[model samples]
Target: MKNKTGRYSAYIRPFSYFIDLAIINLFAILLLSENVYSIYFVVFSSLSWVIIALNVEFYEVYRYTKIIAIGNKILKQFALFTIICFAYFGIFSNHSNARETLIYTLLTLLVVAFAKIFIYYFLRKYRRLSGLNYRKVVLLGSAKQVKQLASFFNDNPDYGYHLIKIFSTDIDKKLAIEMCCEFTEKEEIDEVYCSLFDLSNLQVNELVNFAEDNNKIIKFLPDNKNYFARNLKVDYYGYIPILSLHKTILHDPLTKLFKRAFDIFFALITIIFLLSWLTPLLAILIKLESKGPVFFKQGRPGIDEKEFFCYKFRSMRINATTEKEASKNDPRVTKIGKFIRKTSLDEMPQFLNVLIGDMSVVGPRPHLWSQNKVYGNKIKKYMVRHFVKPGITGLAQVRGYRGEIETDVDMVNRIKYDVYYIKNWSIILDLKIIFLTVFNIFKGEEKAY
Candidate 1:
């Protein structure tokens, strides 16, 4: 729990998965390949395993995960895997005998299940004995649930949660919250536990912002009076329920991999087929009307509030107020810039940003640093938009919330759409947004400029 190498604990689950996959494929080649193509079986079985595992969250075992939960996951995975194995034979028209196939699957699952449970209990024993893979956590508030949680952490060392301190807000709430933030910053606290019944909306927001900004996990200890929102994930540590902010779909490794692969493919096609020739053509037009760079690059806040330079075709003249948003018939915009911006051509350069991993094809548009600063504090959950990569075209843009935030309401609506997109993201939704974006560009949006 106190090992310096404990920071690498995040890789352990993925490593276990790799080992399991190896065992599966090896068993397939050895036992199930007599009458079938070994390579085909290996490929099909491997893909099936990964897909089923992800669906069942087979590798999400945690320190507090019950043995019964692990068994449940194993059973679910094995059941689905068995079905896929039979379906594989039917689809490929292989004549492998049913009894032989069943035996091979049963053997493979037995070995895989053994490895899974071994790693799970081994980590528990390792943490309890050596104190190696532990998380340093701090508690906030003085609610009854908070006290129970603190006791739970103290009583269960095998869970690997080392309680650093408890900052009780009973005496002086404001000062205690401030001191807790300072202590968290100074110490190596991995997680913050806030009791929902003891803190106000403002205090909870402050704690959430501090935790997110510093890359620490923040969880809420909900009281019976509080409603359990759909956006919060509920986990049980013994009989006590802990609520965590639900992570978006993009947080899943498989989902991220698929989205990234799609982004690269889309960006490559756009660059090769369109941007290859269009860049120089727009370059001349931009240069003829403006005495500045052909491409405009500005720092924008991306995922996790990290700053990155976003690229666009230069649509405005050299100006002192480059950070300011453009207005209707603004003198700063060049003739070519007007056309390009109106036609959504200026954003074409961001395909390179997508290719380089700075952005996505469809997401919340990256905001100027100035806009983030202005709206971040004024609007609740404004910074939540940064939870995912900014995009070239987004749901908000297609919904007529793009360009020139004329009022705070415009940004509020945009944030609503952005959060919706993040919470309910899918490949079909992304493709739909892309289609709408193209249609918007051709049909001309009212706020295009």
Candidate 2:
């Protein structure tokens, strides 16, 4: 079910990286050989270029990336790199000439930028003329926007998206969707372009699940009314805009690494400083109050809808209604449960879940598997929250969507916030949610029963 790429296409970026490094070091040695510490300059410049490139996403140029975007990246990388080069000499007290350093930086960046632009256009021309490196894409829906998108794909072969088939939703909707999925699976389709206006919410959900399960890329053609939807990356094919479902900043490998590192660090601190002693005290209270274990583990879906046992302090006495959410004055709540739930102390044990890598320190809070099944069918895009690891505390919880869901509106609003958080996630946003959560714990939320 894996999507296939051209034989040498995958190596292009890595080759570009190697070539850029060579250019940088070669220029440094050639232009700054007068300095005794030329080797240091080479290493410093090489590392700086890579780090800067990652931050600026310099190598993220794709077939869909515009020339203007490439130029912008080049200018950004050059500016930042120029700063790094000058700072190195200032810090190390190297006697390299200022003019020579400027020349080296300029020549190195020019060559790298030229190589990047050349590859970008070369791929475009190659795809158009040689008919290689093209993705086998299926278009679904019969909306006007979808028609325009199909036309764009047909007109611009240089973009490397081969329009395999178009399944019109104007006919029998269910049959069309089924046929689309079947064809996609049979043909080894690389991507599916769906029009939001043509498909129902449930149908869209099914497509999303199918794409996830089958390892196919799914994008949406947002209608004119919903063009400004949040949490999706919009890519322009000429004047037409297409929305990508999984293009969030979190989708970046480096970004995921940073978030995972942060999660581990934060989980360890909480476990060592808070939970280590707190768990023993909490366990004694729970045992005295009830006859069951101190910790309660409930099956919940994590990232990709995979089942994992979510950990929490035993907040409820052993009851037949463990799957049911606790209301304001539910009979299942133990005396200790009331206090822990109010103070948000019951969720502290989930640091273990975070440490174990089944969850995150900050993300959409995992719900009961039963609740997920119900709401996932009831609400549109409700399951999108599972795209990231469920969290102990989340944007929805901090925004007062925590605890019992009394109405469908409550869950709908919660899903909105969850989607927004996923789309707009940043390290700073995670910190803000943590801060707001702490504030809510003390200030007392009305629904934190």
**Which candidate's TM-score is highest?**
1
Give lDDT tens digits, candidate 1, residues 20-105: 88987777777765666467777888888888888899888888899899899989998999888888887784575677678877
lDDT per model vs. reference: 0.85, 0.85
Candidate 1, pairs of clashing residues: 1-131, 1-132
Per-residue C-alpha lDDT of model 2 across residues 397-435, encoded as one tens digit per residue: 999899999999999999889989988999999999999
Clashing pairs in 2: none
TM-score list, all predictions: 0.70, 0.58
Worst 10 residues of 1 by lDDT: 1-10
Alpha-carbon lDDT of model 2:
0.85
Error of 2 at 205 (Å): 1.7
In candidate 1, clashing pairs total: 2
Error of 1 at 146 (Å): 3.1
lDDT of 1 at 136: 86
In model 1, state the lDDT of residue 135: 88
